[model samples]
Structure formats: structure tokens, C-alpha cells
Target: MASVTLSGLRKEYGDLTAVDGLDLDVDDGELLCLLGPSGCGKSTTLRMLGGLETPTDGDVHIGDEPVTDQPPYERNTSMVFQSWALFPRKSVIENVAFGLKMDGVSEDERRERAREMLDVVEMGEFVDHDPTDLSGGQKQRVALARSLAIEPDVLLLDEPLSNLDKRLREQMQLELRNIHDAVETTFVHVTHDQNEAFTLADSIAIMHDGDIEQIGAPREVYDDPVSLFIEEFLGDTNLVDATVAEVTETGVIADTAFDTEVDVRTGDAAVAQGDGLSVSFRPEELDVERVEGTDGDGASAVTGEITDVLYRGSTVRFYVDLGGEHLFFEQSVGADTAFSAGDVVRVSWDPDDLLAFAADGARVGRGET
Candidate 1:
């Protein structure tokens, strides 16, 4: 296993910059996931690490050696692509052994290593199956086996499970985590799927544009997002626009679009009256109760009429119309309260749970009491 590092990494195409000056470090035997939406330079960053793309500026290091100038084959890394680029003409084991064969290993040794990798990936029984006949999940396993057959120091995975069905992809996420544990190879996985990153990564680096926005364990980043982009990208939540009405010793009072003035616990956040703020109300943090009249009493509670009710597999989502603005909350389907459209309800939450962001997309307060 080897620790990987990137310093001042950059890549540009004519006038378009895919990767800006970015620096990152991957610990030995750690699984780090680069997570972001499309065109965020995550794949470009991964390619640079694997020596598949040369950085326009900056350096790449593996372990203690600088490898910016090294070619793909010269680096001790293997990449599993989204396409599962298997050889249609070769058997499963032959495909797995192909990399070793190219590296000048003897036929007997390469085949033995291939069998061992196949077993590690739980594909030992399909050594002789044709690649064309394999299912999507089976193909992905074979591709993984092929990459692992060479015993690379750092394994690069570029959306390797994106092609599988939802259930199969989820299953593969767990299996991949197990495989990483068994092999202990340094892994750098790139994906835009939030759940996948949460499942497989020892740490997640959220990318925006060409640089990393935030990096931490799954729950750490999710629970304490540093910016509005990070908060919005991590999951679904109700973002309401508001303006500061007054600043007090305890917190700030903000007039929200929900036709109510709410108290936000802004921990040492610099703000003044009339400043615009985007307040996040996460669905799970909200408490909802069916009400008859529009009058709701409390600084943290507001009365709204249910506009729509969506029945998800295990949870129900409700959209509420407060004045002219909309906010939503969710509840498990087995919950006792059964709300429908046109039902007036009171939506309330703790002031500390609200995360406020300024106009510049920076989080206003730490939300600490």
C-alpha cells in the first residue's frame, strides 16, 4: 500500500480549465471518494493521479517518490472504468490474467494469480465464462478482479458501479467496501452518488468546480457542512429565503418567507439587520402536526396548508404552502399521523437545527448554541 499526494495540480484545455490548483492527500490503505456532480473535475483529478492525464501544472507523488512525469504503465496503479472494458474474445480468467501477461509474468504464475483474484471477488466459479455472456454485476466483478490481479499499490475506481441496477449497485457498494478491507490497497474512487460515497469511503472529499470543497467522514460532512453548496449537495432540504429583522444576545430574528419571524442561533456569525440569509430546514429535523386554524403560536412554528403528498416506498413527503413560499417535510409511512393535501398543519423545529447561509453562499452561523 502507498500514500498518494497531489500538489498544485492543474489541467486546462485551451481556454477551459478542468482542474484548478488543487492539493490533496490520500493515506496509505485508505478509501477516499471524490464526490461531486458532473463537470466538477473529479474524473480529471483521478486520471491525473493514475498517470492517465498529465497535469498542466503541479506534481503527483506516490509514497515517497514524485511521479508527475511517469506514464500510466510506470505507476503502480490500476483503474477500473465505468464501461468494464473487458475483452469479449477472452474468458473471465484470461481477461483477469491479461495484465500480468503483459507485465511478462509466466503463464502458470499469471493464471494462478488470476484465480486468486477471481476468488477474492467471489467470481471463482465463473473463470471460464465468456465476457459477453456475463451480467452487469458479473462483468463489474470481473473487471475488479482484473485490476486486483496485478496487486497495485493504489486502485482507481471511476464510477465502476454506476451501470448496475439500483439494488445491484447498492449491493456492490457493500461488497466493494469489504473487498477494500480484505486487500488493504489504497483506493481513490470517483462518484457523484452521495449514498455510494457514504457507504464505501473512509473519508469523502466533496469537489466543486476544480477544487475540493470539503473532506471528512460521511457523517461529519453531512452533519456539519461548511457552505451552502455543501449543504444543498449533500441531501434534500427546505431552503427558505429570509432577512434579518433584529440581532439579539441569544441569536438573530429573521423574517422568513413562510410569513413568520424565526429565531436562528447564530454562533458568533457577523450579521446585521436587513441582511439576506438562506435558511435550511432539513426534513428530518422538522416536527409536523395537523392543525385546524392558520394561527400557530411560537417563534419556531408556522401554520401552512398541505399542497401535495408523495408516498415514497418507506417514507411520505409533504409539501406545504406557507403564505406564498413552500417548504417540505418527510415522515416514515408507518408514522401515526396521516396528512393529506389541503390539511392545515403546524411545522416547527428547534432554532439550533437551522443552518443559515449568506448571499455569497457561505454559511452564516455555526448553528451552535
Candidate 2:
């Protein structure tokens, strides 16, 4: 296991910067995920680390050694692609042993090590079966076993479960986490799947337009995003316009665009009077009911008419019209009560649950709160 570091790492294609001045530190034995949409340079960053692509400038270091000049084989890092890339003619055991064989290990030791790795990946029973006869998940297991057999310093997985169906993909995610824990290698995975990143990553680096927008644990980044892009991108949230009305010792007070002034007290922020700002709160944070009054828990309330309702399995999504503006609220149905479309309701939430961001979409610093 090793810690990987990139300093001012850049990659360009003519005038376009595919990866711009990227800097990151992936701790030893940590599973760091490079998460972003397509064309955000996540794959390019992973490739640069694996020595598959060279950076236009800056350094790639493993431990204390700068490996920007080294080749993939010389860097001692093994990569698993989205494609399984198993040999069709080779059985699982043979495929697992292929790398060790090429590295000049004795045949007896190679088979022993390959068998052990297959067992780790829960594919020991299929050691003698041809990979062509295996299902997609089984083939991916074989590929994982093959990658593990080499005992590389770092393991790079690029959307390793993208080819599987939903159920299989979910199952493989746990399996992959198990493999990582068993081996304890530094894993850097790249994917666009939000839940995949949240489930598997120790820390996530959210990239946008060839730059990192935020890097934090799943809950931290989700609950307190640093930008409007980060807030909306992480999950579904309500972004309502508001203005700073007053400042208090506990937090700040703001007036919403809908003529409703509420005491949104929380921590300090870089806000001033009359400054235009935006408030973000998740749908699940709101309390919805059929009245315009507060639930008497110091909860701020916004009353509106339910314009639309969509059933989504366990929960229902409600579109509330606050005059001309629309607010989305997600309510989990229980035996206690239920709601439907065209119902006039009041949405209540605590002041602490409200997040403040600047009009320019950047997060207000907590120091100024």
C-alpha cells in the first residue's frame, strides 16, 4: 500500500486543457474516488496516475518517489478497466497466474498464489472454468482476482461495475469493498455513479469542468456543499432566493423572495445586510401539512399549494407553488398520514437545516457566520 500525490498535474490536447492544474493527496491504504460527470477529466487523472498517460506538467508521486517519468509496469500499479479484459481461452486460475508467470515466478508458486486470490474474490470454485462460460459478474470477479494476483502497489478501477445490471452492480460494490479491505491497497476508482461513490469511497473528489469543486466525506459534501453546483449536483435540493435582513448572535435572518421573512439563525457566515443570497434545504428536511402556521417547534414555515405529486416507490415528491416559484418536497408515506396533488400545505423546517450560499454560487464561509 502507498499514498499517491499529484501536484499541479496538468494534461492538455492542443488548446484544450483536459485536466487543469490538478492537485490531490490520496492517503496510504485509502480508497479515494474521482467522481464527476463525463468530460470532467476524471478518467484522465486516473490514467495519469497509472502511468497510462503522461501529464503535460507537474508531478505524480508514490510515497516519496516521483513517477511522472515512469511507465505503467515500472510504477508497480495494476489497473482494472470497465471492460473485464480476461483472456477468453484461459481458465480463471490460468488468467490469474498470467502476470506472475510473465514475471518469471515458478509454476507451482504461481498456481498457489492464483488459487488463494480466487478464493479471496469468492471465485475459487471456478478456477478451472473457462472465462467465456462465466456470467458478467463472474467475469468481473475473475478480472478482480487477476488484478490482485499481481500484488501491485496501487489498484486503479475505472467504472469496474458499469457493465453489470443494477442488482449485480450493487452486489459487486460490496464485494469490491471487501476485496479492498482484504488487500488494503491504495485504490483510486473513477465513476459517475453517485451512490457508488458514496458507498465505496473513503473520501470523494467532485470534479467539474476539469477542476475539483469539492472534496470531502460523503455526508460532509452532501450536507454542506461549497457551491451551487456542488449542492445541486450532490443531490436534489431546494434553492430559494433570499436577502440578508438582519444579523444575530446565533445566526443570520433572511427574507425570502416570496415576501416571507423568517429568522434563519445558524452559525456565522460572510453575509451583510441587503446582500442577495440563496438558501438550500433538502426536500426531506421540510415538514408539510395543510396549514399556513408553524408546527410550534421554532420551525420556519412556507405555505403553498401542491401543484403536482409524483409517487416514487417508498416516498412521494410534491411540487409546491409559492406564488410564481416552485418548491420540491419529498415526503415518505407512513400509516400516520398522506398527501396528494392540489392540496394547500405549509412546509416547515428548522433554521439550522437551512444552508446559505452566495449569489455567485460559492458557499459562505462558516467563519463569517
Best by TM-score: 1
Alpha-carbon deviation at 214 in model 2, angstroms: 2.0
lDDT of 2 by residue, 54-143 (tens): 999989999888999999878878888888899988888999999899899999999999999999888989989999999999988888
Each candidate: RMSD to true structure? Answer: 1.2, 2.5
lDDT of 1 by residue, 1-369 (tens): 899999999999899899999999999999999999999999999999999999999999999999999999999899999999999999999999998998999999998999999998889999999999999999999999999988899999999999999999999999999999999999999999999999999999999999999998999999889899999999999999999999987678999887689999886679999999999999989999988896784689988899999999999999999878988999889888989999999999998899899999998876465
lDDT values for all models? 0.93, 0.85
Where does candidate 2 stray beyond 4 Å?
A: 245-252, 265-268, 292-299, 333-335, 367-369
Stretches off by above 4 angstroms in model 1 are 367-369
TM-score per prediction, in order, is 0.97, 0.92
Compared with the true structure, model 1 gives a TM-score of 0.97
